[model samples]
Target: MTARWKDLCLDADDPAALGAFWAAVIGLEVDPDASPSTPGPVSLVGPTDGHRVWVNPTTTPRRVKHRLHLDVDAGSVAEVEALGARVVLPAEESGFGWTVMADPEGGEFCVFVRDEPPAYRLHGVVVDCRDPFAQAAWWGRVLGVEPVHHADEGYATLEGAGPDDRLTLDFVPVPEAKVTPNRVHWDLVGDRDELVLLGATHRWDTPGWTVLADPEGNEFCVFAA
Candidate 1:
């Protein structure tokens, strides 16, 4: 059997505090089973449908713009600001149809202003890399995303299994190289050794999961299945 995408992991110093922030943002509760003093990832599931969110404890701090980020449809600008999200890119500033914003912890996420109702609040996941094609293909294989879609040199994307069940993945090119642990990352269920064979470099490890760096040094994790 192969592994599957499990949750979107955010590395933060305070797992419970960060977890609580997202819990309120998404209307999900912290998993009751999560130990407050575990000193690791605390999983949050809820208000239903889509991948779970995990706030992972880390000593690394965010130093620059995030290479990977979530896109949400958090209410109006007032509501978003009230919830501690601030604008990074106003809709009028970018050609894209989404507004770039950052969470309380400064994790970059976009708020897509759409007429249709928001899809479980979370919409898309964006990754920045030096080569969109290679990164997209690598993650596609690791996550079982078949026939990955290759856009132009600037962009690439692939949809997940169920139509509306999970957020889509988008890979876009950036000039700078990733030199530190990514603040945002994917959490999956798979074998660490197998993943290493699949081109992931083992970085650090924690109980039930192994932190790995992708071909480009982007960090992610594999949980035992």
Candidate 2:
């Protein structure tokens, strides 16, 4: 199975607006397979090869820390700024040089100078819900990863299933209700049509892709061959 940083989930109130903003910032194609009636509901937009960010319609308002987040290392601060990222704090010279900034959606990420070959890397993903245990369990069942450690009584993490891939799923607790659509989502690689029997919902009138969500409403897709 060939895998890299394929997707990131972004909770948003207005899926369309947020998706458009990210498309401009990251130069990604929007609604690559979405339709008019259902509105895709799940937007998979980002760099085609390296990374793809999904915008999910979120009902709960963001008031506390993000359960999931990302840390990106760019070649230069100028390049990211030109892409519409605002510098929350100016770049400071440290023993190791790195600059931090926030995306258009108010998500914080970093830009560091490194010589490693940059293909596709998923820094990390945070999963938040009212019921942490259940949500974690559901994801584990779908992805084949289990809880490796607990961050607190309200949070836990699922470690990567491989030696080469550095992936961690952070599950956090939330008190608010989900109100809007999900702008970002994931794409599973197993049997596409079978997932439909697993509560996966088809979006719009598309045939190549099918949108599915967790019990908590976190969305993902199954790409057909």
Candidate 3:
């Protein structure tokens, strides 16, 4: 009924370097042509049904707070803490229990222990960037989803049909790039037509995905089958 974690967001002085670093870490194939439209570069990692990383461009130095962050399940909290991430504040038990964490970059995202998955799996993944339209254009070529809704360029969503019904992709904008490597990303699957209409633009003759920038210049993936 709604969207879930779509893609990873990474803030870096050099988007290309960070993207390359992740490509190696995740065993994701590097498609050079998939760079973002902004002066900065972008890259796609992994298969459609696995996970994807987005490298956001930023010149601002790491600061006091993060606009958004992720709470990942790496088996245990201690497991991720050992990787150099810190707790901004101690994890708390809420009406609904959840864990709060600050990534290596000091951003905040929450993790929840759930008993059930969404009724319908993610139809498609999305990445918020500087120019949602431009990013949509890039991904439209990657996935075959058509633009179904637009919000004053603030957001753009793509739609595709599956065994059940059509899927959607929504790209939103934020003020700045994330200061840490993204622990949560998307795994795009399905056919290229399903991908292209979603707003992925073709850069090369790759089998899947096209690199693109968001309305605010953030990077995201457009996985094609």
Candidate 4:
């Protein structure tokens, strides 16, 4: 893989509180590097594969809808709600059996039912773009995964179920401009210079990571690792 799925970066006003909520939901503990008043980002390191959940502090309130969001599977939607999530769209039983929900900070996500147990609870990170195929292809190169374009439903996805992949990233079409910083973003781990050559725009830099926006203006971090 050219790049690894390092972590999920969540921007919130109260990093520790939000991080704690996600920690419980994802069935992980808050890492020693985080605290309620730590004045920086808090993290919940995943059990396997060294995945990370970074809860970052931000004063910006969410203004518009998110172009990308998370999709997780659990026994019940209420289980997630009990941990500080709320229903944004009620349960849908038809095509995709899931419920649209929001976190306490108003970041949108979806919850689906999983009949079988999961290895890593975080299912997939979804993106909304104008051209799903193009977007997926670009990300596929960045993540070093195969891009399987779907022209029927107008979306493209890579499940990471492939023998050479390890993380799933999906893209669907949307007809609107992205107007705000995403509350939820991914941390891309790989060569910074190579990522820039792969159609990523270096937006800014944090202490240990560089913020890069995808072709669709979706911001994700490229960790120095």
lDDT of each: 0.76, 0.57, 0.48, 0.77
Runs of candidate 4 with Cα error greater than 4 angstroms are 93-95, 116-119, 161-167
Which RMSD values do the candidates have, in order? Answer: 2.7, 7.2, 10.2, 2.6
Residue ranges of candidate 2 with Cα displaced over 4 Å? 1-69, 73-83, 87-101, 105-121, 151-153, 161-164, 192-205
Question: Candidate 1: deviation at residue 72, Å?
Answer: 1.0
lDDT by residue (tens digit), candidate 1, 106-159: 888887765654536666778898988888788778767753655644677777
lDDT of 2 by residue, 20-43 (tens): 655554445676576133434545
Best by TM-score: 4
Candidates 1 and 3, the one with greater TM-score = 1
lDDT tens per residue, model 4, 1-225: 568776677888888888888777666678884654667888887765356777889888888887888777777888888888998877764446778888888888888767763655667778889889998888787767788778888988987732124446789998998888888887767877888887888898878888888888888878767
Error of 2 at 130 (Å): 1.4
Ten-residue segment with the worst summed lDDT in candidate 3? Answer: 117-126
Quote model 3's TM-score.
Answer: 0.38
For model 3 the local lDDT of residue 22 reads 45
- For 1-225, candidate 3 gives per-residue lDDT tens digits of 111224555666667755664454334555567786555747655555234556667766765444334333334455446554555444454443446655545545444433442332223334546666765665555445566547765788766522224245556576666554233334344443443455434334445555432233333444443
Which residue pairs overlap in candidate 4's backbone?
none
